[model samples]
Target: MIFTGRGRTRFLDAVTDFETAVRERDGDRAQRAMQQIQRHFGDAEDDQLAQVGPRLAALLPEVPPGPRGMVAVLIGACVERGADAAVCAPYVFDGLAEALGVAGEFCERWAATGGGDFPAPDPDAADGDVLERVGQDAADGWFTLPQWEMASVAMLNRPAVRTALEPALRTGLLDALRAVQEASGHDFKCLRYALVVLDDEPLLALHRPTGTGYLLRMTGIGDNFQLHTLLADVLIGGGHVPGQAPSAQEAAVCRNAPGQVPTTGAFNLVTPGGEWVWNEGTPTDIPVVDDVRLLVLDPPPYKRGWPAGRFFPGMPGDLVLERVLGADETREWLERCAPPK
Candidate 1:
């Protein structure tokens, strides 16, 4: 997705060409346009893909059958990239099972594969049974297929829908996980944490993720005091301050040291030597001084939770070791996926 200056204009024009070709049913022109899409945005940032992929999927009906596969690819890519799949067109899921290379026989494929992870749903049990399940995070995969797609996964009551989506769901997930691991040099599960470096703050957050960050967010450290935890009372302090925000403290243990909130929702965690590691599988086990350990709130991928009021990217990254906060604006690299180096 490297489009700069005139190249940027060409990309936008290509989008228009694709739409026009779709309306006119010109397969050849549409193919060219689709290639442009993949070329210009195939590796785009999740935020960018979030905008384009679902919109194309929603227009599936107009897309030539030959190019519709790409639309499906786009949708799946959005899912894999941790982009907000919620915005995908409702009908996109209507045929997701077939689009994932199942020859339009999701159920048959599921049966043939011997139910990779789940037994085939009983025809009798699915009779008018509305399955209510909780939504799960996309990065963490799903307890149920389409866990948080906001796509018509709610149609679980329909036996056909449930049966059909399984093949595609499983197939797409595994493929995406493989892609994630290959690009990151680690397992998908390990993608949970970004090795954050306050190297600019000259501090280290190590592999501390959101669960650990929340505790740090609320806990105020003081001089010579050991906060009691179930495990033990760990001594923590920032050079003797009882009434000071993290920003006021020294680089030692100061997370929101910049005292300014990040203006964007995208953020990347980096290494102490200043390298992006959030998605590239960079090692996060490096050790740092206890006092220099920063506890910063972890951010969700992209801006999916914005309407849910999670728009703020937290104030901690303002430490300014690198452009951790503005990561999404520039996609020249792997999200700068590391904190700004």
Candidate 2:
């Protein structure tokens, strides 16, 4: 008991010192105090989990960006599988229900089970024929739609966002990020965003490329959904790793398409939001590009719209402007560009 009291007093003192350091903007002192606190606190008896939990919580409020990236990737996978609003909605609902250990009986009853009249053969059909026929017969007075409509109940869940809508949404989102970078002094490729889902809440985290700071928000998925939602959210928000800083030679513009005016050809542009763009603007002119490009494109901006390629704003719908040449053509181009031994 005496040890416990001493531990508590030390923990509180360390916290007070850390907070004071923060108020003073003393990074070094704050870090030292934090390290000291951790050295004593990490090994605290599990019995004190309740009291220490809330006190330590304030130290790191921002969610990490790595998990957010993972969620975005998972959402991308679900979208690729042709998951529509309805299917995705149910899947997310089921996942959340399973996590919370609270099943919706009505929802379960209406859900398609293998033993139901409409089975795998008609999986492609929307809601299968069972619900459709039920709707049709209601108009003829042979049946009546339920007072508690499935769609009405569905509204409560908000469904998983539509997969078809994601690519376009993500594209615009990238543009927003790029625009942010154009106005900042930092390298855009050094920043990234991630969406995370926690039990009952959904959140997002913007990670700086240096991994020093993170911007986190409670967006809905983290507070209301399963941890899987967190995974899905991360899969959806992608990121770019920082590459070697450019040298004066690397910043020099190479020739663009033959007929282009005598502007500084094309050097690599690292935006403030952590994306790379071809320095297509004139060298003397103030370059204004969006920061969101990091989430949309890959290392070399000239590459096609592959899974890892960068996105630009030319297309009205899709994020990709056009597909680049095949593997053979790419190989040949690289070989030609390679410097002589």
lDDT of each: 0.36, 0.29
| lDDT per residue (tens digit) for residues 100-198 in model 1 | 223213333333544343322222222221122211111112211222222232222122333344455545644644443343243323112211111
Clashing pairs in 1: 1-40, 199-202, 269-338, 269-339, 270-338, 270-339, 276-338, 322-340
- Model 1: runs farther than 4 Å from truth? 1-3, 42-50, 78-84, 98-341
Best by lDDT: 1
For candidate 1, report its TM-score. Answer: 0.30
264-297 per-residue lDDT for model 2 (tens digits) = 2112233333434233221112122231111111
lDDT, candidate 1, at 171: 52
lDDT of 1: 0.36
Number of clashing pairs per prediction, in order: 8, 55
